[model samples]
Target: MRILGCSDICSIFTRKKKINTASESQLARCLSTLDLTALGIGSTLGVGVYVLAGSVSRDTAGPAVIISFAIAALASMIAGLCYAEFGARVPRAGSAYVYSYVTMGEFVAFLIGWTLILEYVIGSASVVRGLSTYVDALFNNSMRNAFKSAAHIDISHLSSYPDFFAFGVTILFSAALAFGAKESSLANNIFTVANLSVVIFVVIAGAFKADPANWNTHPPCTDEDCKQGKGGFAPYGIAGIISGAATCFYGFIGFDCVATTGEEARNPQKSIPIAIVASLSVVFLAYFGVSVVLTMVLPYYEQNPDAPFPHLFDKIGWEWAKWLVSLGAICGLCSSLLGAMYPLPRVIYAMASDGLIFKWMGKVNPRFHTPLMGTLSAGLLTGVLAAIFELNQLVNMMSIGTLLAYSIVAACVLILRYEESEVSEKKNDNTALTASSVLKLIINANKTTHATKLSARLVTSLVFLYFILCVCFTSLVARFTHDINNLEMWIIVPMIFLIISLVTVLFCIYLQPVSGTRLTFSVPLVPFLPALSILINVYLMMMLDIMTWVRFGVWMIVGLLIYFFYGVRHSDISVRKISMKSIRLDGRKNVDSPKFT
Candidate 1:
């Protein structure tokens, strides 16, 4: 950080200790591999799998729905490898938010943090909305009457509630986070395991009923009036597959969440990375296998793309099958959303400690030892978004923001590596005598310093590549794809909105003051990743129509209004900046090494 003097560096160090004040004793390092793996699966493989199968089959991949799932799986695998490494290395809260802070830049950190508002918070809302609809269906189907008068409510003021039970649950999760890390992890463990069983059961039993004929031809495409067997393979064609991938990509976003727990997880160096890859692998298998069975058991067009999977078992007369699926989804969402709740506050706390956000955001509950302010804000925003936005809109917006953040994080790793290479070599010149020995030393040092950098960049790249397919596929639907009912328009708008939001956020981050930021963990390579991230991002935007762009503009305006009116003066970062200057002469501020048993 050439921008800061030695005193500034000292200030940064002092602030770091304050962000995570919990002792390793306060937080449980007890998350087993199974526990971690379960969190990964629970979060990654939620309701998206149930709904996406029908959407892809009916609109995008057709029988090639298998291939679309396969493509997403591959993309996730590539990104997973990087995430694993970072999770292992950083093992800190704030996943990409922290990754950007350490390896990328502050603006990058802020952008990721801000955009994640779309991911976890918006995502939680989306899930709640989905769960609400499903619950409503179950109640109505079972009761055969209006249960509104049943005097039962999941959340009060049903129509006014954010999404579904999510806001309600988020309030609880935020409280969970504030009180302690151990309690949250334990809660995460229970829900994750329950959901894992659900996916495994869905996959195993589902496989038994597959009919091969479903793969041979399409019954019909409701998206268009088609002759029998005419709209076969690539159901929606390459274009539709791409579009569907964009939407379906929502399922894969879960794997990335594993990184968000980098700081909290025990042995994060080992667990975080493993959790990511394991989760992706597990979800891929389940999603692809389940999608195949879904098509086989029922005609792709026959399935309601909007509400397919839960109804899958009920249609077959499997008693409580729909309920089981719903239960699994609810549990899975609870655990993942809880995990999401943990990272953002730690990040805001970290930023505050660094003078990025409000000082209070960085302040720990002395009694609870958690970031009280950060977690609360995240929960509040999540509730509001869920209450207002519909499921499809929230999910679409989330996809764009996630893709944008992942893509940039990937590029930053590469950029940092390239810049530091020359300096590294110039310093290490002729360190050893023998040619082999010298070569070995240089190579070893480069590997030592650049390992994290390389892995991060590659992961970022693969993630970006996956989203590219999603963008292109979705855009094709806009151009050559035809739809009578306007479902395609939903995908188009999100893509466009994503581009606008990404660009605006990037500009905002870039325009920030250069004083307080530092590039401590830069890996290497820059322009290439950024350029590609930008290109693919822009292409995604153009692929959609004006309507999508307009909605995205609204989101940006809202974000700006919040930042200028509230976020600016109240930012923790700014507080940290002031705190940096007000240290004790001896330079110690009640340091504590928090640990979870």
Candidate 2:
């Protein structure tokens, strides 16, 4: 193998590959836009509505959890547009992985595929663990003890007990996937519809049961002691709403699952975008409506973590509604698990087929024509993880993976668009002049366009601006609220950042471009929207605790080791290097052409 150097690293990061949109013989294109939309709804609506609604309200945001959901939805919408553009352009499996490969390169692609495992596999495991909690509520603790005793597994001495139901659900869904895509879609559709019905019922029921007294925006809390203890609309103040938005980001995680279904989607370019947007909009409204009524139905303090909806019904003396709500949660969770697990195998299959993993992992079952081996492997691994570990840390780790991937995808969109604009300008110049004269024409423009120069500088300034502003805001808030000796030092950083930010802003204003290339189906405001998306994702990622960052770093290290030792040796790029090799970004290869290196 050839040793890589600085140029090679730059090439890997900067060079783009043609998208692989060839129809695979193994996977069927049977999913419609509605089917894709249902998937988005199914994957996202389960745990957020059933579990997180009350938990976040009780612990963090109180009645302002509605704002949290709204904030998260806005961030997801911004990221969703980027996903839509790529999905439309590529129409391939491996969502961000394929996008990065075509626009970023193989190494970045590998990292994205690795990060996606956290989003899909570990994410599914987290969902399964959540499912078990609801299952325990439905069956009572008796069922859990029965399974433990029957299996001769005694973890009574441990801090937390194992969840066998979670393990069983993972295996069950793996079997469903092995059966085929058509079957899985049918089940998903049925369960998703049921989940929707449940959400609607909760909203309607809670509306009728709502008490005006429960809608207090302020409830006699001015100090830290009352803010930390009480459960009113603004009990924890503005900070709680912001923190809740970061936490509620998990609710918006599922809409991107539609991107992973490109290989199987009919008219993927249209379907993926529609499904992502439509599903996110639907879920946001549902979550917002349910949250509004939930707080009004019961004080945030009295909400149950596992069965908040049912508890609301029971509170109103409607035993029938309580059971009905529980049943809906079960269906919702089952569909969510199905949606979560569906993408993992396909992602592994995409990577394996590219020779980044064991080749056998790419094999499709003859009868089902799906990635059976990968499905089973993903299932067993998630089952074990869900069974053995507590999911609080795992869920936190999952969110970090999500934010990291979103940031990369946003960057990819900006880079790819910029490259396209360059290509357009080159073509326009060539068309207007003869090839010999084109070289002498001198183009006369700056090497970097004004927009490009400003964007680069603005992004850099924003990063510093973000940290500094955050520090200033926190320190200023702390100075008034708590005991802090070095308030002046804390204030200084923000002041410096503010000055730098103002200078950069003025510079950008002065250097605005006269005209730029426009993208078809592109994100509005080009660099600004994509840049903001990245900044927001990074901010939320920073809000995650230190241990989550540690876990994420460890995961990245493992991915790097696998890539260096296994992927680099077996990758298709490596094999092509031994013969004639040249990658064309224009979707056609000229192997006889000279290599860039």
Candidate 3:
């Protein structure tokens, strides 16, 4: 029991990686703000712009999908700010993984890195699967038909036939990444430029066919006939808009890819924040413009869900434009594929270098200045996933991992803001928590450094606890909304507890002094903005189905096993600490004894 309760075991998990040691990266630093912005845009502006706008407007938000995009964009921007601040401060390869390691601990960092690998792998596979499907549709489903005829084998949750095309595309791009950062980034830039041009063309061309009457059209139906109510600009109402915003939120996911390239950037502090904001701005404009044009060019109900752009051009007697749009769609998907795959190797490298995973994965190719082996490994794994699995099976898994990562990054920003420094984790002095002591601590928080640090740490922990409870409370309400009348006591008690906790957290945060540590760029509004980001992320996560949670749990278990069995023993920090301790003991023994002359 004592062995199980050993402090050494507990301390090992909470040990943080020092940022100063990771400041200089082995990877080549060649990316500019433009290149990074291109990465973000290319990675983010995929099939969503071409398909999501039309589907969401037609089925969910009506013309209000415009508002849906705006709402989702706002949430994404808030999360992006948190990423920007961390990217400027830490400027490491692993997006959330490195950030969490520096601020949280090794255990949390490993879990985040594990989740990130899941996100990128699934994200890449989904992109390529979409690409294969799009191409098959363009070719009249010949490829799918051929595969179906040759080797159709459908499992319950897998593809009906192997997606060889998707596999080939994934491997090809992975090889491209292995060539070098600059080369891969150049290709991404070209594809991104082409993708943007297509977006501009769509907006311009569709604007000519826009009709204001479409936005105001009211279908003749009673409340019983139309659950969403009579058709208009907001045919689906506020609930529908919020739901659509949840769906649209996926469109803004790839922006964090910008943060993953910190090590590759020439001036990460300046360029990373700039790239994150710029790419998000560009991606939002593209989505918003397309949604507006899509709703305006035709009635929301009339829009096609699968291939809206090509069909729109066809409906309007522009057959040539359909082919052009199809070509653009392929380019966009290719760019998205590259963007999704780009981060996986870098994240693996970061984790591997920290001795959390296989150290061989961290090796940078001297000639290419890239993680060649890891790149190939990731590409092969993603390719196999794309080749064997259906897109539906892979897509849902991506969201849970991404939302969790985003939520953690937001939480990290909040914690880091109140921290005195990166490595300041000393235990606070034991003090009684009486009313007068609390009042005095609050009052003198800014006057005394000790008070400031102590209060900041105490309140930060409280805020985190409150945040967990808030998520639980929100999930409970959502789960039992129908039974609220009968469960009023259950609901009311928790709600009251949550309110009190929120008020206390806010008050403490306000009274506590912020860290004096400066950064070139930092998240403003501190606890409020980050707190909102956490709430939004939690809400969105709650929106995911139960099966997603199950899958996430399974992945987490696998990660924990690896961390305990391998990472705990082989960690570089643990090894260094042991060596330092041994050195101190040896010196102490020598000093204690008399030396013979």
Candidate 4:
């Protein structure tokens, strides 16, 4: 009856989901480490391997695109570690959503789950669209032209014609997932192996044709191109390489799909972390090798953006290799499509089972033991999106959701690392806070409930401060990138603030006692590693264009509305709390009454 009160509202929104309750998953634990690794590789090594190397080399970093991929890979690995630690600790289906619920609270969890749905939908749709286009091109664009001739619409954001092929592919994959988890993963493993084989072939074959001079020579350039820093290994200079790293960062986005299988992983504690690290290493090598061969085989300026590998083979008159590479690209895209769709339904099921969304969506199929309804729903939505939307319009919207999720996961890792566990909380509650006591605790650096609590608060505040400082520093650098040699007061002031913020964070993290709770896998350098992950993820998020922020803001607004209207009222945590309170009040009243006996 009093649920609408301000206190009640705050309690419901801020309540954290218990890890014990969340670990009781209905899904079957069928996935091995290799299966999970395949998911990561399949998801991450998709269209990017085939297309990204050539495009970034030609336009952004030139031969230095190899360095760009390496930088991006490093950043991705840091974020991947954060995910791995949480996966080992929580071992749930929702990935960041479940991690946040146990660490951050309910509302934040719902928002993350919502954002993940957005990321998967857009990512899968875009990949399917790309696959359709590739297949169409291979057949001389006959399919696309036929669709264009049949029913062309002149909408701005929508495609010129409906992409039925993309829609069909999405449905087909969704059905495979609904049939069973192991079945889908088996298919993913097959396609992933094929994809990797193609990458190896490309690297080995391209090596014989590679000319070292391509890296050293400045392809004939106009005066404007020269002035823009075009020439040599880094035709666009350090600035271009950094810019290309930002673009290449998206290529590494799919590795976190490994974390989403926490509920289904046969040995999540060890398997999830191993899969994340191993998969990331393999993906980085693939990207690094491909970029090297791509830039070396063809001059950066002459590289093709559309179908780089096939185009390279064509230029060299290697007709056989071109066909082989094309087959590999298709396999890669198919795997990526499956990888993207695989996680969406799992996140949905996690949210729904927690009563954050419709309960029916969380129901596991009796025979298949999969979230069949959720999978079908996700597939339908993704199919319709791929059918109507233009890829370019949808692509920019993908990274923001993922980056935000990564930042929050990293923050969660940092917070969880410093906070007292339940056992410690019971012990620490007895200690009273006083100025002298606080000072003594700080001076002693001994583990106490009070000291641990204080340290956690300090770490939380410092993390927020670090985020602000990163934003300021990144914005200032972007504004004055060209004039760095002639630094002004504006640049100097932000740089100092950023340095101080980071140093303070490090000091607080150093002094804090880490949580006693151990996991099979833990991120090395507690607080520091996760802290860096948060900073890097946020900085990359800021690198996105203004339009991306605008779209992200719109999505957040929609999620907020859903939370306040439906999630708040129907949440399992809220209902259980209310029922328990009512029962306690009734018992107290009976105790106060006269004894009937």
Candidate 5:
């Protein structure tokens, strides 16, 4: 009944739990590296590659969408590396949620788990809507109209009609997932292969037919006679490229889903890293190749969102190929939906088991050996939401949640790395200030020796400092100058770079370790890389519309309420510590300040 103090709150934040793999309660570890990689491909390479490519090209980046994809790829690479490091280190079920919980604390972990519901569950719903649209397109819109008429659920202000196919697929896949992981993986593998083959065929066929004239810039003009200069390759200029990158980022959501499967992966440390890297590489190449071909096959202005792939072929007089590509898209979307849905239940189970959600959801079905309640709950919710919401609304809401999660994972890596270094410094009794302890050796050596051979950390810090000074000098110059054509560039770009470089340099100088701790596969520049990843994620997140922030805020509030009310009371870790304290305090003199055993 005593009120929790600062120490108690800190204890909750700092608590670390080791997963017991030998326990009977653990999920099956049947997924191989190949299964994980395939899941990544299935999840990451879906509707984005097929649909987003042309839509972005027409509406935002024009021919410069290729650069947008590259920008997105870079952001994803930063996030992916952070994920690879944590996924290897933690090897748990909740992906970012587990990573945050283990490193940051229960509150941060609960928030992340809630955020992931937005990423995976809503992601699945968005994909379902896309799949339904594609199915309707393939079947001449009859099924959609029939369902809409039969139900006649009024939401004309929200969506055209209920997407019954979306709802139906969610149920079907939920049933499939209830069967077990192996069966779900098999289905994903088949659909993914079919999707990739179709993608390859499109890339190959489109290359031969691509016309050079299509690549030329055509500015927006009201006069039909004017054939060029609507805005050129970068119709919207540099701003368009950045905006396109923000939107295109949604395509790279899958690799992290691999992290969620860590509990089920065979040799997760090895498999998770390999799968994350391999899957991302494959998807990046696929996205790049498809974006290039899509732009070349048709003018950017002509690209359509509803059916970018098939419609392109249809315009080129290959009607049969359109239908074929449509079929492939349906398969791709379904596979993506499967990949997206697969992670939600595990996250729910992870959160529930931690007492952050309904405890009943944590229970595994005896027959299926899966989180049956979580699966059903997630599936039904997403399906219902998919039926009612517009596709753009669903898609627009996804990026902010995804970026927020990625930023947190990156932050966790940075925190964990620093914590590990601190712990190592405390534990290791080695007093050597020689060559063995690199930084200390530099400090303890003679001035002449120090002058001749500065430590690696010192050298790196100096280099970072130089860059920071240069950025500061440039910004000052830009601020004082009067002749510059683009005042915005001088005032904004240099100042931003200056801030980032200064932070990086300060971290390098202050956060250096007395002794380095190495891992088999750690991020190359520990804090720097993760910090950079966090910055990029935050910058991209800022580009999202106000509605996204509002929605994300609402989600966070709900998660906090659940954590304080249910999680605080029922937390397994907290309960264990409490019981231990009660026993240790038995008839203790300082009852109020009793020691924990």
Candidate 6:
């Protein structure tokens, strides 16, 4: 009668259980291509570009802030390609969580699912926090007054409340999430479209203001200017650009979130991949142009935390622009919040299907088809976090979790490819074919060849190598370059969260390996690509101050408690299910499927 920690929960989640793989509940797939793309933009695009871009440009790398965005975008794109292919093949709900369960094991999936909470729930509230801080800045006489008033909302329940304006905003969204994805998607469509329109207009309108001289203002640094402008190209040079890129990584956190909705989307196979790639491409252009303009008009050195973006508007004597920008930011962030809200609950619902969480939370609304209970829990959790936590620190933790997840997902694609190849090579000769068919032969051939047999070992080797590098970047690089005391107190907390989540994931993996899951292709050298992703991402995280690292700890503790107390018993995941549905990739019966939680 009493299910408690690992052992108790393990009984319910055991691999031996032979339950029905047939799903009872099916959700209506109402989203169109446009809706899906809009969801991507909703989660991506906002403050990361509009707000953070300016600060990095001003304070860190000046004009080269564009490079920072480019680097982060490039690294994300590598992982995104893998995400696209896998998401298309699977189209399930748990996103990386579900993907990991099938490909690596349950434990990895749990780690990913647990980390996703940091990425979305905490990340979404950070958006609200960003919105509030910006709004508060406008209402108060000065940015100083806004910072004081904006960081805390009056709540008897939680102390260290930041910004009441966003407090109401988060509450409104919590209720909205309860309604259904369609309603939220619909609201998101209207606001995000209008908001994006403003961005385009700003880009065009600001184009007229550019001084050709402005382009010349900061050239790629000669050693001379490094001494004058405090060194490097623009301000931070290549070095600063790297730092800015890491900091701005927070800005682009939501792009991968789009992949999470594979199950709910009408045509997830085609849609999820398209939207993920297209969304990031669009944001890249938008951010690059915006940063360029801000630097030209005011100069990045002139910008500081006091009034990062609005101060630029202030200089233009377009105080009205500040209001307009704020409106745009609110609209954009709401969409970001919407994109985030849409995927996470369904993941929990999916996790429940696997028997990882409370089964009660997995209930889907019969008519609306939303995972209402999961939605409510995620909303309540997010609202509380938004009401109390600081934005930058929380966002950093979100990035770390997200990067780790992305790196894993990307590596899976390669692993599965090699896995398939190796299996085929065992069945037949892999070396007889010409070099052309050699690669293509392995790729096209099924999982039964002597070559593919070698490929599996190759795949496993690369996966380990890539993961080690990712760990190094986050743990070693982030700690050494960015720490203040050189003690790295900030690193310890998130490590605990990461360690615990990974352990839970490891447990899940033991219950079920890739013995039964799908691996239909032959991929090559996954280690290099994933290692690149890890290196780039860790460098980015390192740029953030110690405070950001501290916030990551808080999120982990909360996620771990929820997983054990709730997710453990509810998830339908186990060794038996994996054995049964390892190759099953359909989306309709997906009504009962848990893709990512």
Q: Report the Cα lDDT for candidate 3.
A: 0.86
lDDT of 2 at 589: 47
| Candidate 4: worst-modelled 10 consecutive residues by lDDT | 442-451
lDDT of 2: 0.75
TM-score for every candidate vs. truth?
0.69, 0.83, 0.93, 0.94, 0.84, 0.75
Model 1 lDDT at residue 267: 68
**Model number with the top TM-score:** 4
Task: Give candidate 4's error at residue 565 in angstroms.
Answer: 1.0
Q: What lDDT would each prediction earn against the true structure?
A: 0.60, 0.75, 0.86, 0.86, 0.76, 0.65
Q: Which candidate, 1 or 3, has the higher TM-score? A: 3
| lDDT tens per residue, model 1, 292-380 | 77888776767778767666776777867877877887776676676555556766665565445456667767676677777788777
Model 1 residue runs over 4 Å out of place are 1-32, 141-167, 218-224, 227-233, 314-320, 388-392, 421-597
Q: Which scores higher on lDDT, 3 or 5? A: 3
The reply for model 6, stretches above 4 Å from the true place, is 1-25, 141-165, 218-233, 304-309, 421-423, 427-458, 473-528, 538-597
* Stretches of model 5 off by over 4 angstroms after superposition: 19-25, 155-160, 217-236, 421-485, 488-511, 514-518, 585-597
In candidate 4, which residue ranges exceed 4 Å CA deviation? 1-7, 21-24, 222-230, 421-451, 483-485, 585-597
The true-versus-predicted C-alpha distance at residue 412 of model 1, in Å, is 1.6
Q: For model 4, what is the alpha-carbon lDDT of residue 388?
A: 92
